[model samples]
Target: MERLNGYKHLILGNHDRGHSLAWWLNVGFDEVSEHPIIYKNFFFLSHEPMYMNKHMPYVNVHGHIHGQKYAGVNYFNVCVEHWDYTPLTFEQIRDAVVPSEEQA
Candidate 1:
């Protein structure tokens, strides 16, 4: 993973348990979370898609939705099955959310 030159953050999945936030941080993650976290005030990161609506201020990037690609208008599914098994960068995520909100 060190081959990649960028920041890395961890959001716990449902199966992740018995570990403290400090444990993850000590393991080398820039940031560690056990629940949804907002990124750059534009992205909602989570293990499972949630809080998706047409009225939110940020888009959701989640995993449990799997190959669905998107769970709703503001959701971007980043499950391994959907992304060819790679992490989505900030640029990739911004590029995915486009059109600046169209009629919906």
Candidate 2:
């Protein structure tokens, strides 16, 4: 994680319970969250995919399932396996959920 640049935020998941919250922060995460957080008012960023249906306007970008997909199109899998071990940029994720024409 130290090799990576920019601000790092860690969202605690089911498998991340071994360490104390302080331990994570001390490792250099800019922000550590125990719960899912909304980004840009629509993206629900979490370690596990939350419920989402086509009727909902928000998108859930999560990673607990690895390469397997959740039920809804609104659920995006950002696990390392799915992304070929490369982290995705916010713009890349935003452009995927919102078409260029709609962005304007």
Over the full model, what C-alpha lDDT does candidate 2 score relative to the true structure? 0.86
Sliding window of 10 residues with minimal summed lDDT for model 2: 66-75
> What tens digits encode model 2's per-residue C-alpha lDDT throughout 14-95?
9888898899999999999999999878788999988886887888999999757665668777888988889998789888
Candidate 1 — which residues are off by over 4 angstroms? Answer: 1-4, 100-104
TM-score of 2: 0.90
Q: Which stretches of candidate 2 lie over 4 Å from their true place?
A: none
Best by TM-score: 2
**lDDT score at residue 31, model 1, on the 0-100 scale:** 80
Report model 1's TM-score to 2 decimal places: 0.78
